[model samples]
Every structure is written in C-alpha cells, then in structure tokens.
Target: MQPRRLALANQKGGAGKTATTLGLASAIAARGGDVLVVDIDQQGNATKGTGIVATEDLVTTADLMSRAETGALERAIIPTPWDGVDLVPSDISLGNIESDGSNDLVFRLDMAFEGVDLSAYDAVLFDCPPSLGKVLFSALIAADGVIAVTEPTIDSVEGVQNLITTLEGVRRRPNPRLVLDKIVIGRRRNTGEHIAREAELRNAYGDTVARTMIPELAARQDAHSERKKIHDFRGGRAVALQVAYDDLLDELNLTSSRVQEKGA
Candidate 1:
C-alpha cells in the first residue's frame, strides 16, 4: 500500500507541531505500523527525539530536498532508535534551503519521491518548520494531506487560519488532491481562555477539529529530553499523553479510511 503522507504544520511557533508529529509517530509505531518521519525543520527536534543525531555522514532532509538523484529518498531513510520508526533527519544545514534561489526548490521534495516505493511504511510524517516558506511549501507539495496542529489560544487560532489559507493556495494548483485532514488542538490547558478558545475552534471548524486534544503536560517535554517515546517514558502524565495520541491515531485512521473509500 502507498503510505499516507501527512504534513504536520503550523506557521506559528509553539503550536506543538513537532510534538504532535512525534506523538503520532510513536502512537502508530506502538500499533505495529512503520512510520517515516521526515524532519524538515532546522531545529531537528524530531530527529533528536527519535535518538538519531544528525551528522556529516548522514543524508539529511536538505540532501533529499535539494538533490535530484532518484535514490536520494531511499538512501536518506535510516532506522531510528525506536523500533518501527524511521527518519529522514535534518540539521542546521537545512536552513540553507530558505536562502537558495532555485526556481524548482518547492518541487524538489516531490521530485525526490518520484519512482520510489514507500509501501514498506504505513505512513510518512513530515515535520514542518514554523513558517510559511519554501520548506513548508515543499512538504505540502509532497504530502497527501495536512494535519494543522495548534493550541487553543487566539494567536493559535489565527495560525490555523493562516495555514488553511496556505493549504487552499497549494491545493488550487500544485496539489489538488491534498486535503486538510485534521486540525488538532495540542498543549491544551484548563485555563478559562483556553477552554473558551477550544470551544470556539470546535464551533468554527466543526468536524474538522480533532476530537482528541493533547493536554498541557510536562511529561511530553521530559520524554523528548530523554529521547524516549511517550509510550515508553515514565514521567508526569505520560500515560495520559499516550492515550491521547492513541485516540488521535484512531481518528486519523478513520479519516484516511473515509478518504480511501471516497476515492474508490
């Protein structure tokens, strides 16, 4: 089966885009699914979280995006410390793509995947940067769908809208098949404003907003710092985060199934 490529993105920073990517990947891996996490962010937090240190010898996301070699994507795939999870890791060098003036830069990622069989994996997750730029555009161009991760704050709601606008622009031309699969609310809190904003997002997006909300728990940070999957991490509220991600994965599976059924 062709893997479902998902771009986890939010133009605004601190929207828990990386956290969501790792969480979902971990959840999928725990369920016996193989996942490829392509870290398109310069920070490389996802790469580190997967316990793969970026190095000069490794073919990183920059190489995969910039090089036209037919085997680049295949060669970039490396096993992470976590079983059932692979990575196309990134580093600070990936930032150079933002400054490169190549006209086909946005299409490079799509080109890199051409003629490659990704059937070995159940899903491919792209960890996008926190900006609406070439990297984000490249990811969207290559992805089958997008999961816009945001918090339930005023700024985050605006960020989701900006991402929705960007997705619409991309779909109008380059990726007409791309869908906004989900709008997930991450880093949720019990604050009155956050509660109100959560209700507001649910009201506005209706079914598009995910039913699973990732709570504001320090365990997520601790797990990332220790380079352990939240499922394996024993920290503050780790089990709760794991359960939330499991629910998110179920929702994602249902969404994918519906899309497949519609296509059929």
Candidate 2:
C-alpha cells in the first residue's frame, strides 16, 4: 500500500506551515515510522529544519519540478539527520518555476514521482509555499489531501478560506482525489483576539478543524534553530510542543498502524 500524500499549506506567511510539517515528521519518526518531506517552498525552511542544507550540488525539488519525466525523484531523495525521515530539499531557485510558461508545468511534480514506490513511508508531506501560485498548485495536483495550517488571526482565517476555494477548483478538474483533510490551528496564543478567532473558526468549520491546536511556544523555534527534533529538544516547554504534534499525528491517523487500519 502507498502512503498518503498531504500538502501542509497556507496562503499567508507566518502561519506555521513549515513548523507543522516538520513537527509531524518528527512525531512519526518518534513512533518508528518513516516519512518523506518534499519542500516546495522557496524559503527552504523545511529543508533546513530537517538538518539538511541544500548545497549547489544537491538535487532538489526545484530540479524535479523542472523536468517532465519519471524516476527522477529517487535520486533526489536523501536521508535527513532526523531518523526515519527523508527529504527532497528546495532552494530559492524554485521560485523561477512559478513563472514558467509551459502548458504542462503544473503536472511535472506528479509526473516526477511516477513509477516510484513510496510504501516504505508512513506519509509523504509537501511543505508548500505560502501562496496560491503554480508551486502550490503543483503540490495540490500531486497530493492526496491537504492540511491547511493557520494562526488564530483574522488574516489567517481569510487565508484558510482562500485555500479552501483553491482546493475546490483543484478537485473539480486537475485532481479530483484531493481533499482538504483538516484545518490545523497553529501558533495559537491565549490572547483575547486569538481566543475569539479560534472560536469563530471552530464554530464555522466544526469537525473539519483539528481538535489538536499547536500553541505558540518558543521551544519550537529554539529546536528549529538548533536543528534538533522537538522530541529530542530539552528546554523551554519542548514537551508541550512534542505532545501537541503527537496528538496531531494521532488525530490525522498518520501513524503506520493507524493508516493500515484505515485502509483495511
């Protein structure tokens, strides 16, 4: 059986998309399950977060997107320092693909993975760019589902709605199998405005909003800066972040056993 491919996305920057992607990958690794993370964001935050720096010699997602062939992804896949997690790193050059005029440009990402076996992974996650551009569309076309990550803020809420609209379009044509799996509330704070916004989203999109809310904790950034998984990081409330990601993994049914159960 093939693992589920999901895109963690938000049209707004600072919505914790990369953090959530890495956190979930870390949680899966902690459970002895492997995951493949494909970084399609120009910022390369997810690439760096997984402890792999994209040197000029490295084969990246940018290269994969530029090609129109199969069997290329295997060579681009590299093991990360994080156990049980591999990555297709990305760099700023990915931004150039956005403006390409080729008619089949958006389909290249899915084509790149054709005939490749992904059963070794529990999940395949695409850390998408913070925009509804070609890069994001390419990921949506290739993915089985989407997890929209957003902050508990007005602008972020609007961004989630925009993402939903985009998903509807993708489903109607390019990728009818694509589903919006969940809306994850990330970087949540205890402030009054945040609390109100969170309530608004839950009431409006009930059940689709994940029950697990990722708190705005400094340890997340600290662990990222140190290039260590939150499960291994030891200070500044890292335990809280770790528990949240674990809960999210369970909620999403992303564990290998849980995924098998679902398929059964």
Candidate 3:
C-alpha cells in the first residue's frame, strides 16, 4: 500500500503546524517507522528544526515543484539527524511559485510524486505555508489527507473553518479523494478562552477533532533549538511532549504494528 500522505496546514501563524509536523515525525521515527517531511513553507522552520539548511546547490522541494525531472523526487529526499526520518527541505525559493503564474503550477507538486515509489516511508507530512495561496493549493492537490493544526483560540478556530472551506473547494475539482483527516488542537493552555475554544471545535467538528491535544510546553522549543527530536532532548518536560505526541499518533492511527507489539 502507498504511504499515508498528510498536509499539516494552518493559514494563521503561531498555530503550531511546524512543531506538530516535526513532533509527529519524531514520534513515528521513535517507533521505527520511516517518515518523510516535505517542508513547503518559505520560512523553512521544519527544515531547520530537523537540522537541515538547504544550500543553493541542493535539490529541495522548490526544485521538485519547478519542473518534472526524472529523478527530482529522489534528489529532494535527504536524511536528517533523526533516525528513520527524511526531508524534502524548502527555503525562500519556494515562494516563487506564487508569482510563477503558470497554468500547470498548481499541479506541479502532484506531478513531482508521480511514478515515484514512496512506500519506504510510513507517512509523508507536508508542512504547508501559512497562506491560502498556490503553494498550499498544490499541497492539497498532492496530499491524500489534511490535518489542520491550530491553537485553541478564536482566530485559530476561524482559520480552521476557512481551511475547511478551501479544502472542500479543492476536493470538488482538483482532488476528489482528498480528506480532512483531523483537526489537531496544538499548544493548548489551561485558560478560559482556550477551554471554551476547544469546546467550540469539538462541538463543530465532532469526532473529527483529535482527542489528544498538544499542551503548551517549553521542551518543544528547546528541542527545536537544538535541532533534535523531542525524544532525543533531555530537559524541560521532554517526556511530556513525547507522551502527548504518542497519544496524538494513537488518535491518528499512525503507530506501527511493531511499536504496538513492542509496547505490549
């Protein structure tokens, strides 16, 4: 079977989309499942968080999207410091797609994966940019599923609604098979507003909202700063972050059979 491809997206900044992308990748890697994180965001936070800084000569997601090369997909995959996880790193150059104005621009990302075997990875995560632009549209067209990452706030909730609308439009034409897999509540805090917003999301999304919420923890940032996975980090509630992600993986059905057998 093909690997599950997911686009972790939120147009609103500070929604923890990048963090969640790496966190889930770390979780899957810790379980001995391979993961490929495709960083399509111009900020390249996901690329840097995984200790990758794509140089000018390197083939990145931008190279993959620019043209339909024979081995472009293979060239873009780079192994990171984390075991069992690879990356298709992106940089500022990815922003050029917005202005390219090619009729086929939106389909280029999907074309990049064509005829390429991706069964090596258990999951492929795309960290989309914070906008409803061509980049995000291309990712939606390319991915099999979308995971909306958001904080429990008014703006974040609204952002999820907007993304859902955009996703619905994409499904109608570009990608009829695309599914909104889940709405993840990230960087959750124990405040009245947060609690109320969480309730609002669950009420609106029902079981589509993930039961596991990523709590506000400093260890996340600490691990990212060190360019290490949360499981590899040694300080400041790292265990808590790991546990939260484990629960989140369970909710997404990403834990491999080997990991479950080992745990059992």
List TM-score per model, in order.
Answer: 0.95, 0.97, 0.96
For candidate 1, lDDT tens digit of each residue in 27-57?
8777767788999999999999999999899
Candidate order by TM-score, highest to lowest?
Answer: 2, 3, 1
Q: List per-prediction Cα lDDT, in the order shown.
A: 0.90, 0.93, 0.90
Q: Give the total clashing residue pairs for model 1.
A: 0
Model 3 misplaced regions, further than 4 Å: 257-264
**Which is the winner by TM-score between candidate 1 and candidate 3?**
3
> How are the candidates ranked when ordered by lDDT, highest leading?
2, 3, 1
Q: Compared with the true structure, what per-residue lDDT tens digits does model 3 show for residues 1-264?
A: 568889999999989999999999999988878889999999999999999878997788887778755545776888998888899999999978788877888888888888789877778999999999989998999999999999999998999999999999999997999999999999999999999999999999999999999999999998999999998899999998999998998888865654555563
Stronger candidate by TM-score (2 vs 3): 2
Instruction: Score residue 197 of candidate 2 by CA lDDT.
Output: 93
**Candidate 2 lowest-lDDT run of ten:** 255-264
**Per-residue C-alpha lDDT of model 2 across residues 1-264, encoded as one tens digit per residue:** 789999999999999999999999999888878899999999999999988989998998889889787778888999999988999999999989988989998998999888999988999999999899999999999999999999999999999999999999999998999999999999999999999999999998999999999999999999999999999999999999999999999999978484455453
